[model samples]
Target: MSDVDVIVIGSGPQGLAAATSLACEGLTVLVLEKADHLGGAVVSAEATLPGFVHDLYAMSMNLFVGSAFYEKHRVELQENGLEFVVSAHPYASAFPDGTSLKVSTDEGDTLKMWRAHSSADAEGWQRLGQLYDDFTQVYFPVYSSPLPSKSIASAFRGLWKVRATTPPAQLLQLVLSSTRSFGDRYFTTPEAKSLAAAWGMHLDFAPDIASGALFPLLELYGNMRSGMSIVKGGAGKLPAAMARMIEVRGGEVRVGAEVVQIQTDGRKATGVQLSNGEVIRAQRGILTTTPLPNLVNSLLSKQSVPSKMAEAARTYGFGPGTFMIHLALKGPIPWLDQELSDVCYVHLAPYVDDLARTYQQAVAGILPDEPLVVVGQPSVIDPSRVPNPNQHTAWLEVRAVPSEILGDAGGDLSEISWDEARDIFAERIIDKIERYAPGFREQILAQVAFSPVDLERVNPNLVGGDSVSGSHHQQQLFGFRPSWSLNRYATPVNGLFIAGAGTWPGAGVNCVSGPLAAERLLRDTHPSKRAFRRSR
Candidate 1:
């Protein structure tokens, strides 16, 4: 007999959501994760010092909170131990000239902040706020939803729903021409454009890409509506809440129980073989987080997946690898601009070309001479980060490190040890931060760094250390994600399916993959339930 109704692998945001959705249907479910603790990428820890909880990866859950998930489950989750803290100021960014901009919760206050830089920008800033306000109420939902096809047709229709309220010509220009240069258009000054550009580049190495112009709208909306939010304990707390919810419904979570192989019998997968010589049968086989090509090449029998599907999986491209630095600072970073004092989010890229070059270097195997860095000072938003009053920890996401930089030898110069590579990357990043925050380097109490190689070491699903699982380019979106025909999460194997950030609405803390997989599983399982009733 089958072991359970469904089994979800990984306890990332996606996995937890899948478990929760399936559990709600009264299906017996199990979730397995390799990490000792739950929450894959969204984890928190005392990496810096005791009592000072540091967000392991991302500090902001504004996107998740602004989403329908929070709207529907906020009260339910809070009762189950989920709590969040929102900061008044979302972000602060500094240019080389010693000027900085801070985004405040109040629109007028934010406009005043911009007014200090440019009078015209004060008006432009107001327009920008309106854009995000409209977006929060409209555009974001469409992108977050399981709307079929991210086609221009879908985009335009989504736009039409809000078009009557927005300035048609301006909105159309922003949507279609957002790629030309977010900083060059709209505001006459670089300060305004760069501030706006900050929102666009969060899509992990977006650079100066064309289609991303609309992304700034998301950033603006997030900052305006919720500011950056810190889960009560840490980023991991969010996933932990989801896991708890699932468990409360009688679901099980297994950690360090890796599924090494799919036990298939010629045409269908009957169960999964664990690395430790045990097998778990799946009466209703489903994988809430499976990397297709990796599965086809390693776990599944060659005959199971069609040659074309295998080819597609092999050809599917994941975006650039993510390199991060976690630091336990000796003291808070002293900033030149007082406005940056309470800032939670900071981006370090002066010119658009410099930012694009970071991506170019990353794609090519070269460590950026000067990388575009994303720094999150969660302690500023959540004072409970560290035990020491004077000291706090910070996380920096350097988007410029190449995937090959961690290897012994692949390209330029010679191969270096992982330790050496991490140290070298950390030194360079700290030096860059010192440029803006002059005494920053001196404040380092302790620091740890992770290259794409280090990220891959932790989660194989994050192939080559890519955070997005796969790229969301026009060619890879929707049905084309992982593979076109395999869009429903079902594989050629009868009971097996694929799920993860590698699927549609590619990557993020969003539960799109999990809920979508659960929905498909529910639909597929209904037939079996009816047949079982007939048999009885």
Candidate 2:
């Protein structure tokens, strides 16, 4: 008998979700994590100062809350010490001129905010809201289902059911439109346009990139409908709860277990060899949640997979880098528009033109003069993150930074290394925020910044700090993700599967890939299903 039914490599959300599913289904599972801590990007720490908790990466639980995994295991996870706090004000945007716009769960409040900017844009927002209601009926099902599967086919059939309500042309446009095009088509005012377009940057989608409109639409409207959620204490709590759940179900999660090689016999994966030289065996299969590069290049032998599949994995593109600044604050961010304090996230990219410029500059290896800043105010939503009620924390995300410092667009830090320029760039980001929120710098009790290089050091899955793991560009999305050959979450190596932010429905707190991958493995390994297939 093998050591375990399945050996999950990586303790990220995806891996944990898969292991949890398998464990609950009566399969023995062992999760191996290289790092001492679980929750790859979903970790929390007192990074800046003692007693001030900050989410290291991926603070938003909105997507995870809406996920199928959560739908199935919400009660068990909650019972296992998982608690979520919802924010009524999901997101907002702060402009250079001290004006800001916010999206609220209340439709009337959101409409009033839009109308204050432009009546025509308000009407456009209303129409978009209607479209969102109709489009999600088709989109969500397809998004949650596996690409090129019977479930996805069933999801497509939903399109036919909703065609009378939502025209096929509109859906096509949503799939193909750029953020700039989508914004221009929907809203006339710069404020309204920027509010939606800035979200594109969160997914490495520049304003002008084709097929970039979908994410912005989804984020803007999705938050408006369901608000936002954060783990009760910190992001780390969710993964800890998952680990506990797995343990209670008789599965094991081992940290500091670095899987250096996947030991295979013929074309079948047998187990993994740790860096320490210990080999752990899996009876049924192995699931890897590591990035695609590590999966194909570092873990597996070149001869194990087809040449084309290996090349595709080798050439899998990671998008622009992300810079993070975690600030321990004496008090709340002193926003010029105080309304921003109540919201979960405040985007600091002022205009669509600025977003396009920053994205282009980063892609071309230049530091942006004005990078898009995503200001996350977790304390406002949940005060337990701080030591005292008067204290606060600010999670600042600076997007579209170059992985390698080639040149600074501002021309100052061109010669300096990221190690040398991290603080300087962080100050530039703080200054940008200060322009919108005066005295913002004064509230900072302590600050810790991570450059693109630092993020990669923290989580190799981040590659060059492309936090979304890999780009979600049209060619790399849907069934074409990672590659056309391995998009179904299975490897050319039988019984070895891959799933992560690098795979389908890429990125975010959306925990779709894990459970979907587990379902596939279960179906493939089921005795009844196998017998039926052989009979056919």
Candidate 3:
């Protein structure tokens, strides 16, 4: 008999979710992580100063709260010490002139805010909200179900049911529309348009990118209904809770165990070989949450994978990089519009055209003069993260940066390595914030910056510092994610599954990939279910 029924590599949310699911099913499972810490991108640390906790990468729990895994295991996970803090004002945008707009759960108040901009915009906002409601009935089911599966087919049938309200052609157009087009079609004012368009940058979607409308619509409407949530203390508590859940179910989670290779038996994954030269056998299978390139190039022997599939993995695309700045503040950010202090997140990009320019600049390997700065204020909702009541932590996400610096659009930091230029770029982000909130620099008790390169160093899956793992462009999403053949979370090699932000329904804290992968494995392992497995 093998040492364990299955061995899962990586302890990211996806991996942990998969392991926990399998463990709950009474299977013997083991999770291995390369880093000394367990959580992959969802880690928390005192990066800026002592007693100030910062979420190293991911912060928003909006997607997690809406996931099936959370629904099934909510009580158990909470019993294992998972808790969430939510905000009524999920997100907002701050203009340079000290004006702002936000999406609130109270529809009346939100409409009132939009009416202040334009009555036409208020009507437009309600119409968009209706569109959101109509689209999500199809979107959520299709997203949660495995791509190209019976469930996906059923989801389309459900879409067919809504055709009287939202025609198939209209829905298809909306799906393919750019954020800019969507904004123009819906709202009149730039403030109203940008309030939705800014969310596209959360993924790799620029305002003008095709197939980008869905994200902004989903985020804006979804957050308005559900609000934004964060882990009670820090993001690390999530993985810790998951690990406890796995352990209670007789599974094991180990840190500092770097999986170096998949020990294969011709076409089947037998086990994983660690960097320490230790091989742990998996009787049933091995699931990997590593990026596609690493999986195809480094872990598996070249002979075990078909040349075409290997090529696809090697050519898997990653989007523009991201830079992060975490601040330990003497107090909350003194926004000129103090109303922003209560909101969970504020986007500092005021115009969709500006977002387009910055995105194009980053793609062309130029450091933009003005980048989109996403300011996350977790302390606004959760106070347990700080040592004192007066102190606070700020999470700044600098989007659309180049992984390799070629030139600077600003023309000041050209030809320098990221190591030398990280702080300088961070200064530009602070300066951008200072424009909206004067004396912002004075509130900074301490600050730490993570360049794109630094992000990749911390998590290899975040290649090029593309925080969403890989680009979610139409060609690489849904059934074509990673590749057409590997879309079902199964692989060319039997018993070797792959899942992560790089898989279907890509990115965010939407802990779906892991559970989907586990579900696939479970179905494949059943004695009478083998015939149903898709051909590799």
Candidate 4:
């Protein structure tokens, strides 16, 4: 009566991770991807020119690298050709003054980088490193596992240790502080401050938002401890590895199969109806990674989801859109500051204030005058991205850009079409970069610009080009992610579950949500195994 134990819809990072987990558990797993390719936004291509590889979305896999789920499956993924290329100088943020603050995997090098800006900040970095160690011991388990009592107990145990030493008020401040406030309190120089603010915007958080400090602390210090790395060839290798894992385990990963409907029988989901009119019945459950709106409207019928859940999905706050520029360079980006050429990821923000204003303007539905652009030269880390060792290819993601092709927020441009606007906006982005790296624009052999609309065309989950699926605002985060009712991946409908950026532990190519959902689903279907897992 049933074909597979679990049918995972979509082949995004989280979806693939979920399906892989299910398959590894010896459950019959089937992964359906609507697109021709398996990886969703993580796809790569020679969009600029032949021998030039570019990632549509450059999601850092540090979370995946550190995840407990990934550790369990590391050998399988690596065996399937998943290899990471690390940068000695991991990340940096540059000011127009030609000064750059860089972070290195070597603690001494990173401390020296901060010490140049402020001696106090160097000490602060050491303190932050200590705090990061403490936070990781407590929260990472919670971030990795299902929200069970044992997991919660681990979090409490870690918190109790911190409480014994640190004051309650300072601990609360550490928990709830904003990046801007946290930076201001700890570091006196703009260099150290800019580093904190730059990392915060990687999520939807602007510098001054509450709990925004968590990301910077986690990103900067944690990445320092656990260096960031790109896939050996391209970011696409990650999903390819996941698919390979499922296939080798005798599970099916089918592309070009669009899931049109979730077939529910009054109280439980039975199967999925594809757009091609084929029905695949599941013995146990259906796991979806679609955006909240599409899940409630397109997949499920009207009034199927409870009113509160439907309202929550309807009112889900999508974050600002992104604009990206891809280039196949004749040679490396000629930088005025030669130190910048070695760093893998660089944040091009004139000042911390400019970064904040850019976010504000994008939220108001307009392009930022000086956008916070993350210029990534993956070739710096992996030379395989170029045709020759001397030549290079790179991509830059301009975050918090308006999804709509309206005029610039600063009233600098007037065109209303993305086709007309993308090039001009790209020019502005190039101009900003050229200010720091003089011959930057001339290094391009071929260049392509993607407006917000172009992003949506590639990945529908990036609705209105909001790449993180939906916003990470306080009301819509953690236990209240997606919705308060649909929290732990399991929906109101029995035998139905969800995962991906739309769920808890929120955004990034991080495989957090997938395994979390898989663990829950595994426990639900095999109650006997649940006690066995709990015992472990």
The all-Cα superposition gives candidate 3 an RMSD in Å to the true structure of 2.0
What TM-scores do the predictions have? Answer: 0.90, 0.97, 0.97, 0.95
Tens digit of lDDT per residue, candidate 4, span 432-489?
Answer: 8989889888888999988888888877888888888998877777777888777888
Give me candidate 2's TM-score against the actual structure.
Answer: 0.97
Question: What does candidate 3's lDDT look like per residue over 367-479, in tens digits?
Answer: 99989999999987889999999989999998889998999998889978899999999999999999999999999999999999999998889998999999988889888
Model 1 gets an lDDT of 0.72
What overall lDDT, based on C-alpha atoms, would model 4 receive against the true structure?
0.83
Clashing pairs in 4: none
Model 2 over residues 1-536: C-alpha lDDT tens digits?
23899999989999999999899899999999999899999999989888999999899999999998999889988888899999999999988788899989998999999888899999899889877877788788778877877766765776787788778778888889999999999999998899889999999899989999999888889998899899988999999999998999899999998999998898589998999889889878999998778788889877786787788877799999999999999998889998888989999898999999999999999999989999999999899999999899999999889998889998778956899999999999999989988898999999999998998888889998899999999989999887888888887787888888988989987888988889888877777875686799
Could you arrange the candidates by lDDT from highest to lowest?
3, 2, 4, 1
Off by over 4 Å in 2: 527-536
Worst 10 residues of 4 by lDDT: 163-172
What lDDT is reached at residue 47 by model 1? 70
List of clashing residue pairs for candidate 1: 52-385, 52-386, 53-385, 289-499, 408-415
Q: How does residue 397 of candidate 2 score in lDDT?
A: 93
Backbone clashes for every candidate come to: 5, 0, 0, 0
Question: Ten consecutive residues with minimal summed lDDT in candidate 3?
Answer: 527-536
| Pairs in steric clash, model 2 | none
The C-alpha RMSD in Å for every predicted model, in order, reads: 3.4, 1.7, 2.0, 3.2
Q: Rate the local accuracy (lDDT) of all candidates.
A: 0.72, 0.89, 0.90, 0.83
The clash number for model 2 is 0
